[model samples]
Target chain A: MSPGSGPHTAERRGRPRDSGTDSAIIETVLRLMEEGATIGALSIERIARETGVGKATVYRRWSGKDALLVDVMKSLEETAPPLKGESVRNDLVSCLEFARRRGLAKRSSAVLRNVLGQIHSNPGLWGQYQETVIATRREAMHEVLRRGVHTGEIRPGVDLDLLSDLFTGPLLARAVLRPDGSLEEGLQEGLSEQIVDTVLAGVAPPPVAGG
Target chain B: MSPGSGPHTAERRGRPRDSGTDSAIIETVLRLMEEGATIGALSIERIARETGVGKATVYRRWSGKDALLVDVMKSLEETAPPLKGESVRNDLVSCLEFARRRGLAKRSSAVLRNVLGQIHSNPGLWGQYQETVIATRREAMHEVLRRGVHTGEIRPGVDLDLLSDLFTGPLLARAVLRPDGSLEEGLQEGLSEQIVDTVLAGVAPPPVAGG
Candidate 1:
């Protein structure tokens, strides 16, 4: 259904809208997604039924399943706190910690895994995910690295793009491959510290000879 | 079907076995897997039909789909060359280079991606993958790291498990998330070197004081 022609949208213009139903639909979508349901598998009818709302209610907010999924992913991105700290190391640790907490959460990793599985098959959803989620996170990390270089805390020639991957990739790989329920709390904390320390040490500028 | 009861096994004991048929089945399985077919989707009936063999032929070789997949993954593991070099850095670079070349190969990444998607869902299949694929690779990398520590190339207290992830995770992540086709050749080479250099610099023991 086109966004402009949906019956619920027309009703909204004539009368007050039910915000609760809107949230209910979104929550249902998130829960299903976290349970490993793909976008193609989640029909609007199923979502509306699961949410105990009419089909028109969902169609009013989202034109289709892809639109709903994009909205849900955006909500996740919005919930993530921005990265900021006194030093580059602190900033990186905090940013990584943010990712760790999210990864450790029940359903979050499953939701991400489901998305990663189908990302190649669905370019439109992938593009939205990149823009709303990945691009924003990368931009925050880039700012920290840029500031570190400006302050001479990091070597001038370090490739920030590669460095970013090095810093985040292990943690992400662990989350996806091993999942959180299997790991001890101490191990998780240790891994975070280890990754941060390694990156910091790697990027530190060499001391001037004979100083 | 039990392993000992298979017609192929019986034939092996009585007369010359059809090595060509065995290879043909494996090749068809790999091709289907690389095209994003799931274990559940690849029934013995389908595989036999695709290979122009009877259901009894496939059943005689593999007890079930999981067994077949495990065998396929083992075949992939056997194909990976062992890491060897004059120094720890060289060993690591070579190891990662092997992974890069494999990732860049047509259809290989797709097969890996397809497996990764279902790893969390199927514990039996996952255990086989871990034993046959992940453990072997990690052990080789561990040997190189252990030698590095003994030679004082890497610091003594470095966490080898976490270090292994740090070394290989970015490459794997890039293969799955970005896929090598989209990246330029120079970028791939540069990334491999950057990862190696950053890791080597990060893990080197502190310079001797006042040296």
Candidate 2:
């Protein structure tokens, strides 16, 4: 094989060339949104102009606006780290701590916060977001609760769907419903542990009488 | 006094004179927001034009746009009913049930839902909304949880503020985060009972052992 034509150089040339363009395009969209450009009103021509790329360059990477938006959301949420196959308590804490960090990030980021705020205005965008991002995270939390039930850590006969919401609801309430207060530094730290321990204490099975 | 100048006639004349204009102005604002007019862009002149009223007519009712918006939001949410105060369980159910209806209303009414979606975009409007509508309801729910703790229905040593979020969060999650699913007929029915019972079971005190 020729040295210049080797796979290593081919790989190096291709990866950065594409990703740098991808992130630049993505950042431009987010910045536009933060500056109050509604997604419904933003067109590809405008985006390419902002990103200093030809419109054809964007079309080559993404088929359409919705497709590009899905990728943009993926950029916003880091791929979740794998859960430790530990006790349910530890696993649950890991799950909620992920949410805590995400909540904190939302508070700190104007672009992300504004982009998220815009999701509700466009039904198509919201549906795609739920399918791509929210559903996966929800299922992971549900799986943790199901495991807890199997191990007798959680009470049987309760709706795991609703039970999972109890665990997630408090954190989200602070995130969306009470956005102003989410910046409280004291409350965010250890919030995951507090949620897990408190809910587990409530749902634990009645002590086996004189066993 | 002349018969036409009596208090009853004067009161009737005054009541509808202001309120008819008030509600008409409020309705115009809501309709404008529903039609995709951003609160930040809407000026008194535009609102007056849309309402088919003189500019002075609007100023006669509200001091400014924010003040007008405050009244518009008030029109969207009906006055909350007094809680029965029969038991903490009953009160919590009452609290969540109100949220259920609210979620349902947001689903059915495009104007209310769209306006709420717009609230996150403008910080001043959101702050006023929180101060006027949200803070009152939140304090009421917190009081219910505190009473539960006092009466032994809720576990002591848990943060009541966070605990209240658990109750409110699931409903809001369905309402805002998972907007598509909130309309299911089955999920809406008995949701308040399900959430309250499920969370209560988790937070209940341990039974006395072999007493």
Candidate 3:
């Protein structure tokens, strides 16, 4: 049915949402971000203009800029593949491995962290990003830790949430801070394993075990 | 004899180095940084202009801008104070405690870290900062780790350098990344104890004791 040719066609203005347009708009936003445009600097209209799409097309999908950014984070999140349901230790490595890879993949993971941090100036955007994206990943890690606790892989008394940060911090500090950039490249190759193992076995001697 | 009247005064065309002028110069650099100046944006000429001193006066103190910044770092380092040397665990707590305090004191430690990271674009300046300021701190931490090993407070066979990062990483990640900004304040107040204790006591159940 030719849309404008008939009254029925005119009434039926509906068309399937173009996934290609959605993808192009999303990529344009990411490209701008990687080029050093912060989340604070980007707008839906600018993104639409850059992507060569109408502003209405962008608004039709996401409610606003923050909504658009949450989706951008989601796209970035997808780059970190899903964790395998292996042993708890193995899963922990997977989490860090993803972080390590992300750190290496980006010129400065700070760009991403900066984006997250900058949005704090806007409570609505920050809360939305935190609740939707950060909380979800945090729960995933907590779920792994909780499962480990049930299996006795993790100790009973330790905090699962804090445990997650402990496991994740060193790799993150390296990636985001760039403090250790001068260390020999080979030193960081097995970082995921190195951190997880050292931590699981306390730094103090065995007698001080379970301290 | 009056300094101007004496022949000796003419020969000694000097006064004791004015510590006041030095403080003024360093404070000006810090104030500018807090106002969002990067290391690359700073110069001896600009600093002297801002501090209301002559370029020659600045040159007499620090040979160049990087030399001046190394002193700025030294001033910031002074704020952290000396470790108590009480025990490995106690010293570790002191280290994280200082980090926690530093994070709280500044609006952004990234301002400090960013200054460091941004300087990496220049190999010479970065190397100077690394060798002088960062290397000295690294050795200090390594020395503490070595002393702990000697006292049997820390375990043998661990890399002292990597171990230091593991101990400090969590509190730092929260500080630098701001991921945990939304968490309860009390949660982080005890962070130094939380990280050092959790890390000292292995997270894995006892059956995996030394793994």
Give the number of the best model, judged by lDDT: 1
| Candidate 3 backbone collisions, by pair | none
Candidate fnat values, all: 0.49, 0.53, 0.37
Candidate 1: regions farther than 4 A off:
A1-19, A36-49, A53-65, A180-184, B1-26, B36-67, B180-184
In model 2, what is the error at residue A198, expressed in angstroms? 2.2
Candidate 2: TM-score? Answer: 0.78
Residue ranges of candidate 3 with Cα displaced over 4 Å: A1-18, A35-68, A79-86, A107-111, A179-184, A203-211, B1-77, B110-137, B177-184, B187-189, B201-211
Whole-model lDDT per candidate: 0.73, 0.71, 0.65
Worst 10 residues of 3 chain B by lDDT: B2-11
Model with the higher TM-score, candidate 2 or 3: 2
Model 2 chain A poorest ten-residue lDDT run? A1-10
**Which of candidates 1 and 2 is the stronger one according to lDDT?**
1
Sequence-dependent TM-score of model 3: 0.66
Residue A206, candidate 1: Cα error in Å is: 1.3
**Residues A111-205 of candidate 3: C-alpha lDDT, one tens digit per residue:** 45434444434446656656655577677788888877777666676776667778777776566445455222777788889878867665333
Q: On residues A88-178, what C-alpha lDDT tens digit does candidate 1 reach at each position?
A: 7888888888877777765566556555555555667767777777777888888988999998889998888788888888877677566
| Candidate 2 lDDT tens digits, A1-211 | 3453222333544464567778898988877765645444579999988887777668878987767776777778777788886899999999888877777663223333434445544557667777776889899988888888898898898777777777888887787666665735685688888778877876777678658
Judge candidate 2 against the unseen true structure and give its global Cα lDDT, from 0 to 1.
0.71
Error of 2 at A71 (Å): 3.1
How many clashes (backbone N, Cα, C below 3 Å) per candidate? Answer: 0, 3, 0
Best model per DockQ: 1
Estimate, for each residue in B111-149, the C-alpha lDDT of model 2 and write its tens digit. Answer: 434344455455677776777667888999888888888
* Model 3 alpha-carbon miss at residue B195, Å: 2.0
